[model samples]
Target: MTDRAGHRKAAVWGAGGWVVGVLGVLVALPLAARDRLPDRLATHWDASGGPDSSMPFWAATFVPALIWVAMAAAVVLVQWRARKSAGGAAPGWVGATLGFGGATLLGAQASIVRANLDHTDWREAGSVTVWVVVTLAAAVAVGAAALWAGHRARVTVPPVAGPTMEIPEGQRFVWLSRTSNPWLHVTAAVTGVVAVGASAASVGGLTGAEAVLLAGPLALATVVVLCCASVQARVSEKGLDVTFGPLGWPARRWAAEDIASARVETRTAAQVGGWGYRLNGLGTTVMLRGGECLVIRTVKGKDFAVSVDDAERGAALLNSLIGQRSRG
Candidate 1:
């Protein structure tokens, strides 16, 4: 689309989305007011022990709707500004705004449902789960819509040179593209799914047996994610890119020359203080849990770390790579 056309389209969508959102809020406002009513005034069944007669439907509706309105307004504003940028920038912002707004609305609904449902009772077995599914689906839909809209607004073309690996001296940057692994990505995705499920179940007051069953999946996923991920690293001429999340890049990089020394470091969860890739207060990082890691100290004494199956071997490989590059 032309810049003017794209701008106009974005503006229309933004305005319409905001309008719909405002309507939703107006519809929901009555739910929130339910909390204000005396106990005897509540006509709906209160067996769930939800906040008594005060449970106003309008208030419940309004809170989420209000949030959506704000998000929609932001989206419109971004769309208006995008006309001048005339490229992919405006689309990105609009899509992000839409996705963010949708998420806020979904979150508001979730909060309300969570407050009303007693998932621990098992009597509400399907209720909370259904709401959870809806919320997740809605969030995904919003994100997908944003992505689609953003794509529509931009010209589609692959980069002529892709990403560069030319790291200049004194610059603290690393590039890792050649080492993207499909297996590691799969493992991370599985881990996240398990973790989220377990956490959700536990949150619903599933203590003792139920909690164990729910939390068990999460624990297992966490362990598997950490264990399977410890050996992988993304390496390029620029630097090493570490992997943590399932679907995308979850690493930070550093320059080769800045790395003054290289070594393998072994650490436990307690010593490293938990799992995944983390930069702690001491400007140090521990990748994964109970694994060997390639630890490189920068000239500034900061650590650039990556998890690899053979830490020493990885460190040696890194050293050799750096040496070759420097000599060349």
Candidate 2:
């Protein structure tokens, strides 16, 4: 409990400090160079890396800061809700977003200020291609670092006793459960539509960079749709078998002997990270939705969890099988 409290406190302070610092830098950079900047700052660049859109000097300064604040608020709200629901710290992705997004915004804001400095008009500002590339690279580095830190700081939950079923001699027992997230199905459908549209557009004469952009999203959406649609969990004498997606080609299995223990746990998306497959301090969780999950500790001391209905019974049966194997 003390460790959990400390983790929560640290997360809050780290997020708060990072938000304030990023916002401050975003707003301060433009103001500090106000005298040397143009009346209008070049805020948008065309595909050719030429300035094509401009905003007033003051707008350029506060707009990015406001955007950053809004994003930070959304992330904080997610963390707060997760804490309330599961009493766990927000997932590592939250910190990664703050780190990468904050750095990207800061870099872009600085680039705009630098590009507009000493220019009489926004149109005369130089291209920011180099700055954009560098900013993205730095953002990725920061995001990865934040993810690592979050994973390291995670507090592991202690083992808990779970329900068990009595296995009679010469009797076969098997349990099966499947869980699906409707929201994920909706997302998959939407992305699939967008991907199909992009493919059609590409075939209909959209070429060059535009087609390339469409292709990237098309491939990404297809992968998301395929992987995150649904999940199935089965437990029997063969142990636990978890298959994913409609085709179920990607699957995970654990032998009865490999399982150290089995338990039913109440988990939330915030605790395990967002929907789909997640890896955090707690362990790997196939999280389709929030609520009851079948959690098992492996002989190697690793943990794996899957959300499903009748998880208590499934866990009980798995434990029973483990006991039978030990006796045999």
Instruction: Give per-residue lDDT, candidate 1, residue 122.
Output: 19
lDDT of 1: 0.48
For all candidates in order, the CA lDDT equals 0.48, 0.75
Candidate 1 to truth, TM:
0.34
Give candidate 1 misplaced runs (Cα > 4 Å). 1-232, 277-283
Model 2 gets an lDDT of 0.75
Clashes of each: 28, 0
- Tens-place lDDT digits, model 2, residues 27-73: 76677668778888899999999999999888998999899999999
For residues 110-208, write the lDDT of model 1, one tens digit per residue: 344434443333123223344445666766775775565445434332211324333354444322211122333345445544443333333433233
The numbered model that scores best in TM-score is 2
The TM-score values for the models, in the order shown, are 0.34, 0.48
